[model samples]
Target: MNQSFPKAEKLKSKKHIERLFAEGKSISKFPLRLVYLKTGLPEETRIQAAVSASKRNFKKAVDRNRIKRLLREAYRLNKYRITEETDASYAFMILYLGREIPEYEKIDHKMKQLLALFLEKETGKKI
Candidate 1:
């Protein structure tokens, strides 16, 4: 309802992100790969995510950072849907696997679609 992305909702931790990738279940739908695992926190529902552009595809750190920003923004906007629907806490990492950087609008659309798919996969029901 606020329509603003807040800092409290963000997922930021190098160790946690790594653990999510290490121990989580993964789902891929081209250009987007989602890895998630349940968390032990009682009241706090936290998400840890990252968007990766392979060095083989993008040689510049600036390009990689830009794409990661776009992906993070898209995820930030749609994450409320995930928070609203699920009671179980989770930690997630989303990887970008495309050969080229996509436009922000396209990335945003894909982010929504992927979030829905992930919710459905985890809950066995449409969101």
Candidate 2:
């Protein structure tokens, strides 16, 4: 078990994220929102994660990028749990909906909790 989320496992397209939001089911556990949809792939999954702290909150792109980086790092650490529990292929988009950027530790904690919630909701199993 690698327990690592590689680039190949990441969802990369804006179009794909848009489609997931349009047709997929959504669950929000504050600060983290999960948008997921079934995919045609044979038991393969992909994830895309983002954080927003742009002009809406911070006026600097640097601030936005830093927040996004934290969110991505958090997701990358915990995605293995999701991959192990689900047999159905899925495309997931995780959005951060917070007014302020958080520390890495805080974001990581929330990521794990959110992923666990998503797994429980989707599979009825606690991982």
Give per-model TM-scores. 0.85, 0.83
Give per-residue CA lDDT, model 1, range 72-95, as digits (tens): 888878888887888888877778
Q: Compare the candidates by TM-score and give the number of the best one.
A: 1
Index of the highest-lDDT prediction: 1
Clashing pairs in 2: none
Tell me the TM-score of model 1: 0.85
lDDT of 2 by residue, 67-109 (tens): 8888777877787887678767788777777778778988888
Error of 2 at 35 (Å): 1.1
Runs off by more than 4 Å, candidate 1? 2-10
Q: lDDT, candidate 2, residue 106? A: 83
Clashing pairs in 1: none
User: After superposition on all CA atoms, what RMSD does each candidate show versus the true structure?
Assistant: 2.0, 2.3
